[model samples]
Target: YLVGGGQNHSNISGGGGQNHSNISGGGGSEPHVQGYKSQNKFLNKEILELTILLRNAESRERSLEVKYVALEAKLCQVESKYLVLLQDLKSPVCSSSEQSPAREVISRLLEDALDNTDPAEHAVFKPHPVSEYDVFGFRTVPEEDDEEEKLVAKVRALDLRSLSLTDPEVSVGVKWENYLSSTMNRDMVHCPELKALMRSGVPHVHRSKVWRWCISYHTRMFRDNLAPNYYETLLGVARDKPNPASKQIELDLLRTLPNNKHYSSPGADGIQKLRNVLLAFSWRNPDIGYCQGLNRLAAIALLYLDQEDAFWCLITIVEVFMPQDYYTKTLLGSQVDQRVFKDLLSEKLPRLHAHFDLYKVDSSLITFNWFLVLFVDSVNSDLLFKIWDAFLYEGPKIIFRFALALFKYKEEEFLKLQDSMAIFKYLRYFTITILDWRKLMSIAFVDMNPFPLRQIQNRRTFHLEKVRLELTELEAIRQTFLRERDTHTDAGPLCSDDEEDN
Candidate 1:
């Protein structure tokens, strides 16, 4: 009976549900059918659950697709912004031909503003050739100061120069009094002649000796550490460093003092010495390493002075007058002086400044090397040396004065310049051509009283001592204070005896 029932049930399941009576013949019970129906219901419930999960997954996928599209749009916007920035970066912003109309008008106005003063009239205001050596001889003490005169006389009688050099023995009373007096008057009193000499140009022949004297006196006064070792160290550095600037220096060297018969020998000793000094200087100051116009400056120096004297003069000029950092790799000081030049132009030659501003002509483009190397490559070497003579006696102020003087001389042609490039080209060619050597030097150095000698000396000495001493003292004090503070901090707070009683 079980076998028969199994066959009948198998047949009913295999067939497409023929009849309920077929299952009854096999004794299939209502409970069995109910159980089968329950099984089918459970399978349907699982299928429904799977369908719901698939729909949820599809919804999540669609949401993710939307987010991805939004991100892609943002990426495309960023790329477009970057492309625009890149395009701008690649563009040349400062082409000279694109100068604004305001610049051209201003240039014309500046040219017109010049009084059309006769060059000869301008020359009349020019300083006569004063005796460079005795320029300050006429300086006098004020008539109103009798007591000061007596004091000065007494001080002068003490032979300060001899005493300063020899360290002479003195009576205790005198020694104490002099020390007090000197302490009160630490700065050297400049004679009237010296002041006049500083204001006027140093004659070319006397420049070398005068420069050496000035450097020696200042070195002794300031007790500069580098002064003693300077030339020797410079030579040693030159020997050690490779001749990196030789080719460039050589190229401009001959061109520097051209037309001067003194420098143009087939075997000129002066020229050779000038080359050596310049090379040595470049080696010594490797950060400046080498610049194009320095050889020209050295060559000009050699034409007027012997090699050793020329070197000393160069040392004084670099260390004392022009900005020390001007010749450095950064050329930062030149830029600063360029700004000062701009200010001078605006104040003294407003028309030129306005034209320059309108045309977008950066003063730096022309003036950077002018101030940095003191127009070594710009003007005639003879004129350059004369400029140097005045520069040494005066200070960096001569550079600005000369720059303004140059613009004043060249106002007309410069006004017609259409762009910065044209302006630079004009400066490179025409400006240097305006002044003959004598005239240029005469213009730059003669009749200028911008800086006092005492002030310049003081500035040199101050920088040498002040910053170094301050830093040293500050470090020492900081160390000691820190130690004391740390000790105090480490010691715990003291307990009161009254608290202990509690």
Candidate 2:
């Protein structure tokens, strides 16, 4: 959060419209110069001291995080042991081969938790069950087959050099496993090595666990406040009581990721899981209830996580990760983000922003879904998960960083285009061709350094107010129109009667 303090201070005078001439009006030039120098020295010293304090605090935070994760890990072990003990007490004499029940059960549970499958293998297109369908489950058009083939080939060719035993990531990968055996700590992102690993990508085998860990940490407070078996409770309630959002949920189930095998068929397991999760969430958060974008979020989570895990991840994303009302009927928070993003675009990629303005194109047209669904279908699955790895770790700022990086990545090309239509077309489809996940991440995290969370929060606050006011004015206008229509309707018959009498 302190990453951008100095930069923010430099922009203070520019941001403020106050005149500086008044400061020197009463004082002589010599005194003013001396005073300025003294103040500058004091400010610099203060900044240095504050920076040191923040760094120390950050270190302490990391230590506490490690401890918290360790404790959680121990708790899990205890729970596993308790379950084993209970089983032992209830069981009769078992086979000699199953002597170490605790170890055997724990090993199986660990294996289930940490899937060792090749991530790329999941992305390979499967042959359609029927002649009309293509691999990955979507019904195929001849035109789309070429594009799908290229994406599949890119997935197959994804680099795995970072996973080698000799690589630094391998060592950090061990730390990641240990870190996740318990709860997640927000400060863990401060670790340079872990941060790099997450930014590069969580290994496919560990991705689900890491995502669960991060989300669990984020929603820890909310989870703690809820009763035990909250998800199950919510599920039961949803089954007993009809949710108003159930129809919408059912409609969206088939619409979500039809191309994926899990969601391709009407009776697919993924479709059922998606339905249950969305229904459960609608019951869980009635305020926002069910939103269209959430279906995609849950669908993506279900790709790696099971039903319960995906549900919690969706909760964290909608309730904790994003701002409130982001997916509400009005979607005020989502609209506010679009406004904030446009400002960020202007600040971070002024040329591209200017190009967008010159073409009379609102950037939000291309970016609304990007932010709404967190770029699910915009990027390939491999890269989508990579983006999400950092997103879950770092927070929403990752979205802005990646958004800016996209425009910056293709800035020159975008500028080369003559008209808005071509630009729009490129913006729409450019992300699908992003084969270099590492470069995209590097551009987001490294090149876009000091993209602080505090700044984004402030921008959101500012835009939220603006959007609220705009909504209010629109409402007022609508009210005035309604009143005028009512008055005209009431007077229309009387006017005709008076004309007939005359």
Candidate 3:
């Protein structure tokens, strides 16, 4: 029998009874059995706990793997964006196929017409040619020398205004017709086969048609999407923007077209229309938002175009023609253009560039408005309109050409400048005085090859790449931070629990 008490035993009395009757096995076995059962229970519990902990750790690792994979995908996407931008920067400025052969021929013809000609030939093209004979095509016969002198004196003495002058209405009509004919003839003469034709001279009567033709020509050349209802889409964009800059645009509405008598009045329909268009544009390009010089540009546009057309034209200009960043807050696009201008100065006028470097005269001092408003603020309205005509046809290159022409024209004064301030003042005010519209334009466009179309494209591309890379880096940093924060948050509880248990 087994004793259930501590340190007790029972005896087996059959064969071994004569040897010894010490039965302590029952008591010892009971305590030993109990200890073994308790140890087994503890081992089973520890194993089960370890298995659960391992499963949790594996789950956490799997989650982290998923997150890392997603982050890597995002990083790749950002890199790809930057690569595309880089590639764009490496491309050419303008494709040779942009202009048709006919356009090129027309442009060449226009250039030939404007080329150097004899004064007599130029006079022939003028509206009024001085004549030696009377208006009726009659030549008086000469008498004696003294009598001839007297006859000439008498003819000269006739009241200057009494020469059988046509009616004022008829005269005005005839003169205007002559001006129109003269302008058209000049334009046709300068026409080239591959480039857009420039409408030279004062196109007072043909302003609308000339503007429309230039716009159409560019639209075709750029293959810009001018689909039906595009204007409506633009208007819709205008209606959507409700930013603070829109208010500033409203305040400066009348001030924009200040010189235009029709739109100068406080409540004029033209002024209101211009306001609407500007405000709408402000709304449409909220990223650029509204800048100070844009109002001036829009105001100038109103002078040449109807409100609706002007709005669309401005949209085309900012979105397609000019560098995208030109109108933005940083004005980085203009800044880049200025950098290019500096490069141009260095190449074309090393002396001027050296002078500028010595004086520390940065291009930003005066070129901001030059590129932003296309010299609208500096040039006369009539001349500015003509520049705009060419601008519409050639894009921003016209502005660069115009700038180079200015530098070329004023190289003498610029070379002599003592300091940056003087250079700024000269560029700000003096350059305008020095330039003659026809002469300046002739210099700007005639055989000009300073900044080629390819270089411009490359510059734009380079800037775009830079922006993309910056954006990508910023996004990468942001994503990294976000991921770190998420990781910290996700592991916080688990770590805290582990620490407490430890």
Candidate 4:
């Protein structure tokens, strides 16, 4: 959720539109100048009072959130203890002589319950459904490797002084900031100067601004939405309406960015903010409402953006950078893109692809989340920021370029690890391995290999047709199922109680 980097537009007439005539209108110039002054004073006072009330409510919300967390922990403890007691009851550990009749009755009833219950319900040891896409589902590192926390140690021990701001980078920051301001202030252009600077990386303090410019958030905000109060309006409408996707959104929010201080704990302001923005988006685009990896993308955007801006930037990615089909029930576009990536990797790096095949490693295992979340947790956070700087500038090709580049750089390590778990460890805990981000960018953008966008687009065209054909097949199957169901229903009770037909 975002939205606040003001620009001057003479027509905005009060944010310029039919939308806020009442708020911005001053009621016909000089004829009622004295009346206008009085009205302005009264309205200003009311606005000041409302602002204070809003602040107070937010403070109270913060306290309530803290209390909710404490209560939730106690609730979980009680539930766990109850489950253990239930387990003991299932085994009938205590003799009837030692306990009361009521207790014995409870135990006996519990035993009956366990006997009737599904085994899968308590099968905590059961493995997850294996997918080439799900690596975080497994415990990757071996006990010996984890004993030393070797990855953590390596990351901590590595010196990254070269990443510190240099004279040239600082100069670029100044130049980019001016570009950002001009862009925000509606001075839009195809600035080669700005795009070149963006490839280097954006400063932390100015990332939100840089991102705003990249997405043309200001332009979209005014042009497409047309309503200056668009974010606020959707927020109000969302609150009043019950969301079908609310439960899934809640679950994902709790698990997202658990280590990042901003989103570490549930019910924190950051969590609430993430929830609101995601829910608003769910409401904004019901067709693609609440996909799993979207929370990670929104969380990062929310960190850099205001509430509404985050929402719109997410839209930009899905509509512009990403194929709309990627986030839907079919996931046709994402799968096609995955195939495109795999083929491209084979085309560009035969040795690496062969190593992957030899180990029975699916390319999707590493690349899925890397692409889905735009490398949110896949790479080092600082490095992810660098990638985002380029991603927003260069478009989705940077993603493919970065993925291929990582494979190329880690070709040796990947070859050494013959097992899936070890390769998965290499992929999942990658950010923990110390990397020179500036160097990685250099390789991804320039040094490692060439990955032409036109070639990728050609692959994409073929994949899209394949997916559409699959979609057609799926729809036919669905229609066949419906016909069969209807026929079965009609054919039922051929011999009725009142009149039987032989």
TM-score for candidate 1, please give it: 0.45
lDDT tens readout by residue for model 4, 318-399: 7778876888777877888998998888887898889878877887976887888898877666677888888887789888
Cα lDDT for residue 442, candidate 2: 73
Q: What RMSD, rounded to one decimal, does every model reach?
A: 39.1, 26.1, 40.8, 21.7
What Cα-based lDDT does every candidate model obtain?
Answer: 0.56, 0.73, 0.59, 0.68
User: By TM-score, how accurate is candidate 4?
Assistant: 0.62
TM-score: which candidate is best? 2
Write candidate 3's Cα lDDT for 1-502 as tens digits. 1122111222221323323322343334544555556546655666687788989999999788667655654543443343333334322322345555644543333333223244454422221112333321222212245532432322321212122121132344455466446777455222442133342433445556656555555454433656666556766766675567767777777666454554557876567766677777776677876777777676666656787667767776788787777788767677677767766667867887788788888765777678887886566444567677677766788887877777777788888888777787787776535424656767777735655888877866776667667768999999999999899888765456668999
**lDDT (Cα, tens digit) per residue for candidate 1, span 79-161:** 33433433343224323445756445433332222222333544222211112121212111123445434223222222222
Question: Where is model 3 more than 4 Å wrong at Cα?
Answer: 1-202, 219-245, 257-265, 463-502
Error at 236, model 1, angstroms: 5.2
For model 2, what is the alpha-carbon lDDT of residue 450?
78
What tens-digit string does per-residue lDDT give for candidate 2 at 41-73?
757877898889999999999788667655654
Candidate 1 lowest-lDDT run of ten:
127-136
Q: How high is the lDDT of residue 489 in model 4?
A: 86
